[model samples]
Target: MVLRSSFFVASILLLTACGSGGSKNDSLPSETPEEKGESLYVLNCASCHGEDGKLGSSGAKDLSVSKLSDQQIEQIIRKGKNAMPAQEAVLETDENIKLVIEHVKTLKNKP
Candidate 1:
């Protein structure tokens, strides 16, 4: 009976160990602001906007030459425009939207 009890306890401990592995994000190293923003943009915006934000696929704007203010960009991201779809649901939070905006700014062409 003691042997059976020990085996049961060992099985439970093993299961607990496997179950406590945590989420995928928990295993990743913390990202810098630029890294985080660029990652978010790549995941959510790269398809239409391109890596340098100049692909302009499907009527997407060329962000490299965009002159819109930050507030306007935020509005367009949250609400979308023309062929673009609203991103509030896709981005999931205002903080994420801001991150994408920061990355977009980095894509602007220097004079």
Candidate 2:
């Protein structure tokens, strides 16, 4: 009887503790253009571009030194460069592509 009672008490405590932390989607949304751009960059770019966006991987060019303009980036995403496949279908949304381009600008020379 004592063991069963202890188990019940523990279960109640565990459940109560879990419920106090709020639902899984309790976080606030990004409020600024830069913040949104960063979020999009992380989700779509960090894998190959790395956190700094300069780490060349699998023959991908270092974005920091690339002379590509925002328009070129958009074009590349829409139609793809040699190695990269066209992301028109994948990054179908213009907002996401624009945000990525904006974030990529931050990868300039680290001086």
Stretches of candidate 2 off by over 4 Å are 1-27, 109-111
Q: Tens-digit lDDT track for model 1 on 12-68?
A: 998887777655447768898789889999998889989889889999999999999
lDDT of 2 by residue, 50-73 (tens): 768776676667777778888998
Error of 1 at 100 (Å): 0.9
As for candidate 1, its clashing pairs are none
Candidate 2 matches the true fold with a TM-score of 0.65
Q: Model 2 — which ten-residue stretch has the worst lDDT?
A: 22-31
In angstroms, what RMSD does candidate 1 have relative to the true structure?
A: 9.4
